[model samples]
Target chain A: MRSRSAWTIFWRTVLGRAYPRIIGAQREKSWVFFEIFLPLLQVTAYVYIYRAIEAPPEFIGFVVLGGAMSAYWLNVLWSMASQLYWEKETGNLELYIVAPTSRMAILLGMALGGMFATTLRAIAVITIGMLLFHVSMTVRNVPVLLGVFLTTLVALYGLGMLLSSLFLLFGREAWHLSNLLQEPVSLVSGFYFPVRALGQVVAAAASILPITLGLDAMRQLLFPAMLGDLRFLPAEVELGILAGLAVLFLILARRALAYFETLARREGRLSIRGQ
Target chain B: MRANGSRSEALRSLRVAAWLGWQIESNWADPFVFAIYSLVKPLAGALILVFMYAVIAKGGLQSPLFPGVFVGNALFIYVPAVLAGISWTIIDDREHYGMLKYVYTAPVNVLTYLVGRGVAKTMVATIAVVMMLLLGTLALGVPIRFGGIDWPLVLGSAMLAFFGILLGGVTLVTARHNYGVGEAVAGGLYLLCGVVFPLDTLPSWLSSIGRAIPITYWVEAMRRALLGERTALFSGLSNGALVAILAGSTVVLAVLAVLVFRLAERRARAKGLLDMQMMY
Candidate 1:
């Protein structure tokens, strides 16, 4: 009974540490301000979306939906992309080298912090879209949308972690690798315009990422009539592909993380951090 | 108060000045290292922009954004590309490698030394701009006729370059002592500066706000020079007028850099940041 109780107590403590870390992480100011600033830019976006729509009601619907949908998109690849870069620069990243905590946990914690922060921006944007732009977004298939959101975040968060791993092992002192990831992703993701409009080649390249398919699938439910004529490899294929990409990116992220950890051990400069 | 004592003090200060000057020259050698490190990110950013444009054009957006427009926009995109990619270097060197102390102690006045460093970086950026221009014209098959070098755009870009270097230099001086967000300092400027696509891509009002920025005029001037448009050649909004503005800004920014450094040094002295983080 004593041994069993000790084992039980250990697992409980493990679970207990996470919530406080998560809470403390989100309460920080970076989360609050960046989220607010991102959605505030949507005032201009509403103007563009309204011009694209045919009817007044459709405009309201599209603007509201676009406001909510855009929350899922942003330029955090810079924020997250520079994880190793910032660490290497500030010397704070050195703590991770010595800490007994899992590197994966540390990375996931940071990403979750960023995602939640960006999601808050998404919320703020939707609030403005509803109040100012007079958007009347409907709730249909909430579960499906949530699933797509989870998977998209998972895939992106995974890719971000993988990039961090690369930077840890291979970054020049400057960590330009983050720029390599952030800028290209922003352009190709079709955040501003429809990816399908990007034609077959970009569309093909984008389909490999979960966000493209998630956006497509989510849009199908939200604006089915607007995009009804457009074919994007069918709903089932898009979701399956997104799921596949998420898994593939996660596997790659895990492998990269492990390789980096091993390399850190071998190099004996894990604590040195940065170039 | 005595004349002999004053002379001895002056000699001691001169000795300090020479030592500081020597330090400044040796420390600035990192510019050569930085200029090389700067190219990788912009090269990647350029390739992505070109590839995305090709794919988007091929997709038949069915808009007026022909391949030529892509080439046109691509050149202006480098303004931000250069700024964003390299913005971190100056600040990063100070915070990461502890190079700021050498800068402060160097014999040359900090402002004059920074002007030279800024020129070196601008020269590097100029080389990158040249490479990007040649690649776009030759490979993309776009006609960017020189049409007697638009001196205005050149001046405007020089001004934009000044803004980038000064803001970066100022940030370096302060951040060495006071911690501020480097990415925010760098990336925010890139977005706010109207470098990538025309902020006109957004709305009329936002575009107006974008147009109000010095970079807007600079990039517009660049577009005119490279695209061979003589229509706005001598308009009141001429690049010459903009170049004048740029020259004024260059002087102001240079003064501001000195001010920031002097302030930073005093603050660092109070906080002991001046003697902090010495590196070989």
Candidate 2:
């Protein structure tokens, strides 16, 4: 057999890893109901809560946008962060380790696949929510919105890659940790409101999570008239922060995956199940 | 003699299953981490509502409506936790742990075992509920009166467990690969049951659907018991009438749960699905 270059192998591994998530997503019909419709229902509930409170119409837009971005955060937590632990439990981690490819490539593939799948759900949420609630937005800057949005995904998935390694190291605690992160992250991230409403200090701390800045930035751009004063920072600064986060997380994730691979080899934890 | 022997066996299974459920849930982390784990999610969940109210309501947490909404959201945790606990047991044992076939072959009653598992989740959720109530009263001034609590209505509301078992029975026959069934139902009920908002907030057609669901009444009853105020939608009914309706609804749910479980058990056995693993 002809030898493949490291670059060739890495690219191929990424493609192979992502294939299942991208294609298999379409194969499963239940995901639409579970992922899209159910989340839409939750968004609807929040919308009703805002209505019940007699909040401004823009608040409904906030809930709709928050509900949309939440799909990505969930994908990061469950499908990306806890994935390697799941793979370990299901006895697939050993195969990936034994294979002669970069572990980061496998993770990148998972990230790409998860991003694609979750985007479909997120878009569905935003579209349906807009139609149902008549949420109006003023997207003044398309390029900036896309830039911040993409950077946010990069940083968020990078964080997921890092957590995947940490989660595998921690074993069963990862499941509880993942659960712990969900609602708390949503709260701190100001998923259904402006992060500014959480006050400056708390919002500053929550910026560690990429979605916090991402959601804040997107909302600022989309709902300038209502959310202009409520933004935690100027959208420009948030974009810069997101870019820095993207780079920092990718570097950290690379190092963590290397350390994890060494530890797993020495400890022989890859084959351990039900931990 | 046979009936007595079977009853004792079922009781034993239930007792053991509850212990096992608690162990599986809490033993993954040390006591400290587990305590933090239990505290954070529910508190954060409550905080989400608090922040939402703060942003919109002029009076912030002091809004007259805050207490009921806070209490309602706090109690709503049980719907998802218990429902997921019971239904996910089927998925966990069958799919994740691959022990469902062995469990089925044993002398255990699956329905009783599921109820036992749900008991552990109820305990966890009760802690969250109590913590939320304390935080509401002390920190947020939610106006809960310990003396005014209707103990009978509160106790009667425990019949909500039957709904979890009913959903679990549906899961036993239907779910092969999906894990979100419990959460999906819970999310829908969160909207329908007026967990955070009143039923009147929903459109009349949707509110009618909410009225039909046992959980809407369950939330309203809990609010009445804990907050000493009846939901305007149900204000027409007196406390006794509310309790009677809850009891009647619970009886219907319990009977339906048993029948559903029996039918699901027969179907699962016929389809050879008890041991089936999708490996997704």
Best by TM-score: 2
Candidate 2 residues B1-280, lDDT tens each? 9999899988988898899999998998788878888889999989989998988887888877788899999988888988777888888888888998988889997778888888888888888888989999999989888778887777656566787787777777776556788888888999998889888999999989998998887788888888899877788988888788888888888898788888888898999888877766
The CA lDDT at B75 in model 1 is 53
> On residues B1-280, what C-alpha lDDT tens digit does candidate 1 reach at each position?
5677666554554455345433432343366655554554455446544543443333432323333333444555444433432334345445565655775665434443443444444455556666666766677655667556665566555454445454554454343322223334433434443444434454576666655566655555666677655222224475567667666766775576456656755665677654454221
Candidate 1 ranges with C-alpha deviation above 4 Å: A1-31, A34-102, A125-140, A229-231, A248-256, B1-90, B112-128, B131-142, B169-212, B230-245, B248-280
lDDT of model 2, residue B186: 87
Model 2 whole-model lDDT (C-alpha atoms): 0.87
Instruction: Give the CA lDDT, 0 to 100, for residue A139 in model 1.
Output: 49
Best by lDDT: 2
Q: Docking quality tier of candidate 1?
A: incorrect
Please write out the lDDT profile of model 2 over residues A1-275, one tens digit for every residue: 23558889999999999998899886788876688977787799999999999998988998999999999988888888889888888779889888999899999999999999899889999999999999899998999999999999999999999998777676777777888898999899998888898899999999999999999999889987545578899888999999999999999999998898778768887778887
Residue A2, model 1: Cα distance from true site in angstroms: 11
TM-score for all predictions? 0.70, 0.98
> B191, model 2: CA deviation in Å?
0.4
